[model samples]
Target: MSCSECGSPTIDFSLPERYRASLSTDAAVANCCTRCLTVEPVTDADTDASTPEFGRISDAVPTDQEQAIPLLLALELADSLATNRDAIESLLRDVERAGADPLLAIDRLARDPDLEPRVDLERRSHQIEQLLYYSNN
Candidate 1:
């Protein structure tokens, strides 16, 4: 998995699920170094569901972490939504400014490539979006 353009050497990685969906589907992903990014089909994603497959014969995939993403996000959003939209916008601006440093922590996990977060940020985002936009009347 070397850099395709530079041939600067590369390695296989078990990337996070958040990155899996962000690619090919979201515009925000355009900012990253796309050349090195690896996007797997949903069925082949190295998610929690992919793990226990080695122990069983069935093909059912496991669900994402139950509460990790939703709790933090809900808490944060509760705070944000409590404030005026302008205040929330300003908080987002501050977050954007603070997050410019792409987390290199992922690079450090080259050895433990299978590590996945407990909160399932990808699934949580989807749930939150549904809760916010789709009324269950």
Candidate 2:
């Protein structure tokens, strides 16, 4: 499903079993947009019983790895840079344009021999790796 706010694709996830018992049929499943991060419940018609996989809803979502990598990079950069919204958006656009693999880029930045002694590159790189690991699993 697509996000109403940004028109970006969404990841569908089922509610936990404990919470599911309390929800009505209409609220059993929910989807969160990959880009905008808007979350809303899926309607009965949108629900599919055939796919019942639990946890890590992203696995079920068909995402473009090329696009996802840049988006993930943007999020990590924004957090690490602690920049304003406009600056974050600009950085995201730049990363998207560069189309470089985020993991490799972050690793390279972390290991740059002549890098300025400002923010902790190694810490940021580790956080990004953890973020990717947790999100995928």
TM-score of each: 0.21, 0.31
- lDDT agreement with native, every candidate: 0.27, 0.46
lDDT per residue (tens digit) for residues 21-70 in model 2: 22223466655555443445677565663343322223322244333333
Question: Candidate 1: lDDT of 27?
Answer: 22
Best by TM-score: 2
What lDDT does model 2 reach? 0.46
TM-score of model number 2: 0.31
Lowest summed lDDT across 10 adjacent residues in model 2 is found at 53-62
* Candidate 1 lDDT tens digits, 1-137: 23334333222223334433323343211111122222222332332332211111111111121221112122233323434333323323332344421112122222223423232434444343444345362
